[model samples]
Target: MTDNLGRGASWQAQSSQSWLTVTASGVAGGPMQIQADPSALATNTIHYATVSVKSSDSGVSAAQPVVVALWKGTESVREVATTAAVASRYTRLLADPVRPYAYAHSNSGMVADPVRPHVQLYSNSGTIDVYNIYTGALVKSMSAPGSTLGKMLASPDGAYLYAHDLAGRQLKVFDLREGQVVATWPLDASLSVFEGGLIDLIYARPNGVGVLVVSTGQVFRASDGKLLATKIAQMPNTDRLVHGLQPFRGLSSSYLAASLDGMRVFSTDSRLYMVPNTPFYWDMDYTETNEGTLSVTKAYAANLGTTLDAGLSQAGGIAMSRDGSRVLMLSAVAGISLWSPADLSKDRMLAQDLGLQSDTLNVTPDGNIVVAGSTFGQGSPQFHVLSPDGRLLKTQVTRIAASTVKPGSTGTISALTADMAVSADGNVAIQSAIHDVDTNFGYLLTFAPIRP
Candidate 1:
């Protein structure tokens, strides 16, 4: 990274998870440093470095800055301040290979962390405050990764987080216990690795065999970052943002459900092929018997008061019922289209069109019901309740207009675009916003499904 500025000055800081913040500017031929947050002093540290650069004139921004860091698993050793700055350890992690595939798995399957309250963030940039099951207030805040971090796989125990760093062409693993990085791996982007730095995660198959990491068109085993197969979902001529994680419990066999932009479900026989477009999306888990097959018999996203899509115009988000028998459609302008999982041709419409709209959708694990952000017509969308078949169970305008969408790319969620996930028991349903807004600080905050 270079600019017209030739000579430069930069500093590097150290901590469990190190970061660099521009501290002092314009040199005064004197001492200029940064102080650590007094509150974080005990938990974190304040490491600073100052460099003496030879410049024709005293111009800060006119000069370039450099930084280097180090990340190693050791004591809470605060880095000794240095006169010469270093870079972030992650910058050098690639030199090693065995540790790159580490990832922090959640308490459940390799899906988004419910401990997270937002919709769009990965566990690294996790905007979650995991609390003790007994007392819920504040635990440590695990942030999302670089917002661009993609292709994550959790350890079989759901304790470690392994994410492919598309930006750096490397794999980063973190220890959830300490919320710190512990391993790194380098990839050959020139090989089965896809282009455009587009990588996403499918569930780990066989529990321990390995999780699938899909990028552009290539797939790899998340466990070893080894290339598995390429171009599984060979969909051409369309740019789709997929939302898939190992279904809460669909890891028994080699089965993985791939959702295309909240629409279309493609069940693969080693690749992403069109299976069926239905009324609901399969969000939670349902383990099959010893025969090695899980049946789709339920719905997760609700449609009652929320408008769903059977057509393109009203298109919004599409999900399968937990049982995989129905489809739950969230419409942009109208009602939801309840389609059969077996045949997209068959459909049912519930809840009249027009009234309001919201971006996020909340779904239960069993596919029995759902909830949506409150947005009655043109005003900010709020929360509403619905039956799996698209009935107006309830309207919650005053309840959740401020819902935030999930933006897990960072350690926080701030998008207002709302999304949902189910807990392990298929009982607790969590709805969150993908995008965020300050006006609605904690909309929905995190929903706990009311008992039947």
Candidate 2:
């Protein structure tokens, strides 16, 4: 309670329900405590109450009613199912935004159809096999002639699937509704020849897709094969000297992320680069040995003070919140730190020295929760759920049984890799854990309704 008449006013607080208690009632306005007792309440039942506050000053017109809601439910996550064993390693896990299904990608070029939630596509040589995600039943198979597609990405609207045709040296855009290749564009022939190809893809505004090439960036029109922007990577003079410009000659991007609005793209090599999506805005020009002089920029290069851990790079060490307000970066030396997207400045250290070496990081669609997973070391692999403001919410360990452990030298239950994906509604999550020794065999775990 506060006095509007600039006079120190006395206030009285009362709770509407017996289960809700208000401490320090009938006192001068400053602060008070409200507590809820849930011991007598039934599980999974929501209870509501109101805290009424009245000011002694007559100038304050009406009493204020503060509503409070409480619910009692399970706080820990439970394992749902384990996937069937395979010989190829699972490289990534993705949760469908529009459906109740999850996709597990493998190193052997397997991806899930974003438009069709239940479809899983796998590539073998030039043949593509489509299967059901839940039942492992083969639905249909198709052929791509001479093209071997890899590094697949789905458009934001789930209308097209963009993939790199490694054998053809081109980018193939497959229309999901038409079920055919709609368009194809030639990539940098030099990079394809040297096995240095596109690293990642991010959605750009105005119906464009930003492609992160080796040490360079480009944007293309998703509808056709028109190139909108090119040669988009450049670093500051100080950053070039600190990281040694020689390594950048052949540096490959370790990770790439974009804000939700698709106006900015973030890429990492030895440091971070925040590239603007505005076309034809060249800030600097630099000459390379074979590529000639190219236009670039140093407008938003950020030095994070520490070189990121290489081991965690493949496990996705960087992520942007859905609202594009927060950027989370995890380094083995610094743990996880939150950064503001507006200025690329450090907001706060979210977590550090968490015992387990975290390898993967993700944020919920609502940007309220942060999830991090660790690689197995001396103990079972674990994942943590946290708030954006740096509060730990839940911690879960895989706890694989010995019977499920593959036969090995030690016969210990451990995972070599673990990755997580949260649903669009922020209520569910799926985790994939690869076996320590087997490498190919792994387990899939699910957490539903993370909060009640």
Candidate 3:
């Protein structure tokens, strides 16, 4: 504490709450120490207290009040259940925003329907199989020829299923309720250059679906397969002097994420790009002939080496909190860092020096907890649950007993290919352990009531 008038006066501090104690009171213009005892605090509650400092000098008019807040997080979660082993491992997992259901996408070409809380959709060749998500019971089967269900995304209302047809180089929209392919639009010709390369697609709210390949971004109407806006990376004028007027097309290999409101799209190479003015165009009707290029605002350099290159080939290393308050980037070199989506400002580091390799990143819908999975050079897989401001709440390691390990295996767990998801209410978290070599079987592990 410092005195306002530069007068070094003796000051005494008092705490409003019993849990908060002032360790040392000193003269103004010096330092004082205070501590908080949360042992007796209730879980999942935020407690506030004030420390009033009164100076002995009469020149100081009023007592200066310092506010302190303490939050007692929910109790740590313990492993509750594990699903039966299956031949096909799920490479992708997601939790529904409004339902108590989890979607698991198997490597054998099965994807859970995001709209239907209890239904799973599997596409083998041209046949679509619908099954119950929980019971593994077959609901119905339908066939749609010439459609490949590679990398599917559901519309906000769950009315349409947007899928990429790699073989045909087209984007197909399937009506979930009708169980039929309603529309098919050819992808941008420029995307063909990335033929076998990484391409990302995300469903933005307010009826916009963004397709990002490297630095090129295209927005389409979710209601129909109409191309709305196309944006190319615009290097700064300083960079143009060195590289000429050519557009910087290769910003990132594949990292892509959008905000909850669908107003902005984020992509990163070494630097972060918040594609500006996305909602303005999508909110209006712009035909292919009338469509114009979306403006580029600014690009922020995160200074983290190879931001999302390591262990992020199949899984997205970039994610936005459900509340759209924070944008998270998982780096193998720098751990997990949080940024403000509003301005692309570095907020703070949530966790650092995670390991040699870190991959999966996710945030609860309420934006309170963040979960990430990492591995230490073929060691047992570990997952960390953390608060928004960098507090390590819990860490769990997946270990298999030596007797349970598969023969000829090293018994080490790898999270390089793992995927994780936390429920909307922050009560449940699920992780897919398909790449665990010790257990040749693929399965889902569940951690329930993770938050109060």
Best by TM-score: 2
Cα RMSD to the true fold for all candidates: 21.9, 13.9, 14.8
Window of ten residues with lowest summed lDDT in model 1:
88-97
The digit string of per-residue lDDT tens for model 2 on 34-123 reads: 888989887644466677887666655445456555535544333333334444444444443333334444422334443333233334
Quote the lDDT for 252 in model 1: 13
Model 3 worst lDDT window (10 residues): 275-284
Instruction: Give candidate 3 misplaced runs (Cα > 4 Å).
Output: 1-86, 107-150, 178-180, 192-197, 206-216, 234-252, 270-316, 356-359, 376-380, 397-417, 434-452
RMSD of 1: 21.9
Q: Between which residue pairs do clashes occur in model 3?
A: none
Ranking by TM-score: 2, 3, 1
What digit string (tens of lDDT, one per residue) describes model 3 on residues 57-121? 77765454665655465544444333344455444454433333344444222333443422233
Q: Residue 253 in candidate 3 has what lDDT?
A: 41
Candidate 2 achieves a global lDDT of 0.49
For residue 256, give model 2's deviation from the true position in Å.
2.2
What is each predicted model's overall lDDT from 0 to 1?
A: 0.34, 0.49, 0.49
What tens digits encode model 1's per-residue C-alpha lDDT throughout 225-278? 554544333322222222331211111111233332222332211212221222
lDDT of 1: 0.34
